[model samples]
Target: MKAIVSVKRVVDYNVRIQVKPDGSGVVTDGVKMSMNPFDEIAMEEAVRLKEKGKITEIIAVTIGGAKNEETLRTALAFGATKAIHIKDEGEVQPLTAARALAAVFKKEGASLLIAGKQAIDDDANQTGQMVAALLDIAQATFAGKVDVDGNKATVVREVDAGLETLEVDLPAVITADLRLNEPRYLKLPDIMKAKRIPIEATTLADLGVTAAAAVKTVKTVPPPSRSKGVMVKTVDDLVAALKAKGLA
Candidate 1:
C-alpha cells in the first residue's frame, strides 16, 4: 500500500509575521520558512505506518513555486520514499491545493492519503476534507490516533465535544492533529541526505488539471495589540475597572 502525504511551506512558527506595508500580504522576504508544523506530524505518521508494514511506499507532495521544494526535501528526510512538486507560480488557494492534491492522489494510485488538519499560516482546515470530497472517498479529520488492519483503518479524532473513534475503509483521507504523534528531529546526516534526494517537479498544466477559481484577499492586517493591564490593589478596584471597560 502506498501513502501520499501532502506538505506545505509556510513561515516558521517562531517568526513574527508582518503584514506588507500596502496590505497586500504577510512579508516573506528574509523571513524564516519551513514545512508546515501539522504537515510534519502528517509525515511522521506516514513514516510510522510504513515502519509498521501498513504502507509500502510514502510519496510526499507539495504545491508552490521554486521555494516549496525545500519543504518536500524535509519530507524526504522524514522518511518519504519519493517527492512530487506541483509547480504553481501564483497563489494556490485552499480549493486549488485540494484539486492539485487530488490529482496527485489519482496518478499515484495511492491507497492512503494523509495531510495536516490545518496549516498555521491560514488555519483554513479545509484542504484534507476537500481532497476527500474530490476523490469521493472516506475522510477522517483531526485524527489523534490511527491503526490500520487490512483495508480498514481506525481513527480517533478530536472534536469539539470529545474524542470520536471512526473506522473507515481503505483509500481514505486522514488529517493529522497535534496529538497524533511527536515528529522526530532530523539529524545532521539526514539533513545532508535530504539535499541529495531528487524531487520530481511538474506543473499543474502537465497534470492536466486546473484548480478552482481562487478567492482573492482584499487586504492583510495584524491582530490588534493587547491593551495594557491596569494595576488594581483591591477587589473593588478590579470590579470598577472591569465595569469601566464594559467587560464586567
Candidate 2:
C-alpha cells in the first residue's frame, strides 16, 4: 500500500493576525508559517502506517508558494519517503486546491489519501471531500482511528453524538481528526537527513487540469466585539439583571 498525505502552510497559530490595510486579505508579511496542526496529525498517521509495515511508501504533497517547501520538509523529517510541491503563487480556494491534489493523485497512483479534517487558517473542511469526489472514491472524514489489513481498511470516526466505524476497500480517502494520533517532532538527525531528500515540483499545467473558476472576496469585516458585563454585588443583583435582559 502507498499513502499520500496532503500538507499545508499557514500562519503560525501563535501569531496575532491582522487584516490587510487594503482589505484584500489578512496580512501575512513577516508572519511565521507552520504546518497546519491538523495536517501534522494526518502526516503522523501516515508515518505510523509506513512504520508498521502497512504501507510501502508515504508521499507528502502541498500546494502553495515556494515557502510551502518548508512544510513538506517537516513531513519528510517525520518519516515520509518523498514530497511533491504544486507551485501556485496565487490564492487558492478549497475547491481549486482539491482539484489540483486530485490531479496529482491520478498521476501518483496512491492507494490512499490522508489529510486534515480542516485547515485552521480558513477552517474550510471541503478539500478532502472534494478530492474524493473528483476521484470518484470512498472517503471517511474525521477519522479517529485507522486499521489496515490486506486490501481493506477500517476507520473509526468521531461524531457529535458518539463514534462511528467504516470499512473501505483500497484506494480510499480519509480525513483525520484531532484524536487520530499525536504528531512527533523531528529529531536533529532526521532533520539533517530530510534536508538531503529531493522534493519534486510540478505545476497545474503539468497535470492537465484546468484552473478552477474564480472566487471573489467582496469584503471582510471583523467579528463583533464582546461587551463587558456589569459586576454584580449579590445574587439578587445578578438575578435582576438576567430578568431584565430576559435571560433568566
TM-score of each: 0.96, 0.94
Candidate 1 Cα errors over 4 Å, as ranges: 239-248
Candidate 1: tens digits of C-alpha lDDT, residues 140-224: 9999999989999999999999999999998999999999999999888888898899999988888877866768889999999
**Candidate 2 global CA lDDT score:** 0.90
lDDT (Cα, 0-100) at 156 in candidate 2:
99
lDDT per residue as tens, model 2, 1-248? 77899999999999888888777778788999999999999999999898899999998999888999999989999999989998988888888888888987888889999999999988989999999999999999999999988888899999998999999887889999999999987899999898899999998888776667667788665666799979999999999999999999
Alpha carbon deviation, residue 161, candidate 1 (Å): 1.0
Give each prediction's root-mean-square deviation over alpha carbons.
Answer: 1.4, 1.6
Task: Give the Cα lDDT of each candidate.
Answer: 0.94, 0.90
Best by TM-score: 1
Model 1's C-alpha root-mean-square deviation from the true structure amounts to: 1.4
Indicate which candidate wins on lDDT: 1
After superposing candidate 2 on the true structure, give the runs of residues whose Cα lies further than 4 Å from its correct spot.
239-248
